[model samples]
Target: MRLEKKVIIVTGSCTGIGKAIAKRCVAEGGRVVIHGLEPELGQEVVQELGPANAVLHIEDLATEGVAERLVAVAVKAFGRLDAVVNNAALVLSSNLHTTDLTFFRRMLDVNTLAPFALIKAALPQLKQNRGCVLNIGSVNGWSGEPDLMAYSVSKGALMTLTRNLGDTLHREDGVRVNQINPGWVITENEARRKHEQGLAEDWYKDVPPVFAPSGRILWPAEIAAAAVYWLADESGPISGQIVDLEQYPFIGRNPPKN
Candidate 1:
């Protein structure tokens, strides 16, 4: 197993890419602490991963002290942390005019501020263990998405946080840090919601599934594999880097430029 004996903390493990990452980490011989708001689903994920491989944390990460609570729990249970994947996110897709301050602030708090607090609390422990950190950024972090202004801004700030922390850790301590920005991945619930909202066409046309030059939609498993690979590998040479899961042409819907 690539990650044998490693202890991994993955937020948002109840569903989607986060769930897949938690499972994959366990399957790769890592022990995981799964975090989410849904107690039942978190327990279900841990159960699905079997006894020794998983545990659960029901946390509203947007709260100020939630990260400290999560870290304390993980350390109390596992004794030490080998890696942390900041995957929990609360998204708000609103234009400037349509968006309210409350909605925007909440998005920033959840998507960006939560990760910052969690990492800060985990830093001393992680530094002691020489552990690594992986931030779940978004394609919106690197590119401009007008529809999701608040979410995009938060993700962008998340990238900045990743870079700043990565640099500090890599230089001062042995800790490594990186960010992963994934493309659109369709889940059953997401599809159903879109269909209900009469936005099926929006999803279908917008999410092209071709990889790299293919412009295809990203699968959750694909992003999970990247997470698995990053933590499981020991070289850990990459710090302060943002790994964009979208291999598609960054400029247009077409293949790579010749």
Candidate 2:
């Protein structure tokens, strides 16, 4: 087990990529603190991973002081914290014309500020364990699409936060921080979102190559696999890095031809 005895907190873990990460962590012999907005899903995940290896905490991270509560749960359950995967995020799409301060603040509060609070709350335990933090960022952080103005801006800030804290904590506290910017992951939430947007249930099947290069979108488990490497001791003190998980070059890409 690559992560034998390690204790990790995976926020937004009740579903999507976060869910996959919690499962992967336990499968690799780690204990985990599962968190999300859905209590039932959180409980189900804890049950699936077994109570001994996992515990659930349902939190709206945007709430002030909740980050500390999450850390406390981890410590209370397993007595230590080895890593934290800041994977919980709110992804709302809005173009410049539709974007407003309310939406912008909501996006930043959940996507950016919450992660910062969690890291700060867990810093002491992390320092003691020589632990690490893995941030689930998005390729959209690179200026995002016109339809995702606020979301893109939030992710860009998150990327900056990851780099800033990764460097600061590594130097001052021995806690490694890293990020993964994933592109077009297929998940229950993503599917629901598409359906809400009037796409067919199998809309992904007909997506253009520009959207899904492999004739399919990325899977949550793939991100989970990469996350383990960064969270585990095997990464060996590396920090301040971002991994872009996508099929194409993020820069200077030629538009797809018909």
Candidate 3:
């Protein structure tokens, strides 16, 4: 396995992309610390990932001291930290004109600030290990989304943060910082639940082809593979790059399934 003996932390492991990342890391022989808001569910994931490779830490990353605390736990339990995937985010579908200051602030606080703080907290350890960081960014980060204005701003800030940190650390600390901008993935559980809730049968039909002419929603496992590639035995000059999860147009390809 490529990530044998590596130690990584993935936030928001309760659901969606975070859960997929955690599972993939463990399967690749990495030691992963899965963070989620719910402890029981997190533990279930940890157990499924097997005894030695996975552990769960439940906490809200947006809390004042949570970043530092999570870092401490990783160091204390795993002995070293090799990578961090900042996957936690908050989204609100609201018009910017009517959205309150509090609502906007909350979006920034959880989506942008928490990731920034956590990366900083994990920086020294990553430096010590000469490790890599993969931020879970968004397509909306580069292109503005009218409905998700606050969320878009937060993700945009995160993309800029990734570039800034990647620039500084690649030269000085040997810590590679990159981001993944995933398009859309429909999980089986979510799809089934939404179907039960009377959701449209072909709602995703309207979403952009996501850089690829092929009209298919990107899978959670697709994003997981990208994370593994970054975390694994990768060589070559890699820094400050945004690995677009959406396929490039006319290539007729899927992302590297490491």
Candidate 4:
């Protein structure tokens, strides 16, 4: 029970990595506020975690004042806020020519700006409790594939935000901020996305070793396991760090040639 008695707010908790983290928090004895746009899915997650361990809040992160509402929900349900996990994102595909101003702005609004808003809204409580913020980013933030221009740009900006606040907040307010950049993970949406892109239903099963060194990509539960450390007191005084959760070294790696 690393997070015993702590109260956390996890955005996008209706599915994928966010749901996994919420489940893990409950397993570790932490209560959570589950936030997402899907009411049905959010209710399901809240049910799965049980009413005593979770509360549901449905809202689009891009909507004005949604961040403040999420913070309010957490405090109302649990009486206090200990941490926040910014796991929601818009993962749309677009290239230089395909991504227009509107599309790019939408991506940034949801992916980057929303996290900043939530952090700001939760700042007072976080500082009072000496709590933390964990931003879920993507490995593509470093320099993404050609087709992921807007998404990549948004994630890169999020990375910078994480580092900047991680340092300043820890120094001034004693609230730690950090980030985790995950590689491709096998989530429900990812499977459906691959099928829509014309891959076989079992495409993930035969992923190339270059992409899946362990013969498979990551699982949401695996990422959740790593998240526990940062949320718990065991991580002591560490802030402003970005950890890349991938099977192999992401930078300066040479794949074998046939």
Best by lDDT: 4
- What stretches of model 1 exceed 4 Å from their correct place? 200-216, 251-258
Alpha-carbon lDDT, every model: 0.82, 0.92, 0.81, 0.94
Which regions of candidate 4 deviate over 4 angstroms?
Answer: none
The C-alpha local distance difference test score for the whole of candidate 1 amounts to: 0.82
Question: Candidate 3 overall Cα lDDT vs. reference?
Answer: 0.81
CA shift at 114, candidate 3, in angstroms? 1.0
Residue 214 alpha-carbon offset, candidate 1, angstroms: 4.6
lDDT of 1 at 218: 63
The whole-model C-alpha lDDT of candidate 2 against the native structure comes to 0.92
**TM-score against truth, every candidate:** 0.90, 0.98, 0.87, 0.99
lDDT of 1 at 1: 90
Model 2 over residues 1-258: C-alpha lDDT tens digits?
999999999999999999999999999999999999899988999999999999998879999789999999999999999899999989888998898889899999999999999999999999999999999999999988889889989989999999999899999999999999998899899999999999999998888888777888889999999998998888997999999998887768898898
Residue pairs in collision within model 2: none
The Cα RMSD in angstroms, rounded to one decimal, for candidate 4 relative to the true structure is 0.7
Which is better, 2 or 3, measured by lDDT? Answer: 2
Candidate 3: list runs displaced more than 4 Å.
188-198, 201-215, 247-258
Candidate with the greatest TM-score versus the true structure: 4
TM-score preference between candidates 2 and 3, better one:
2
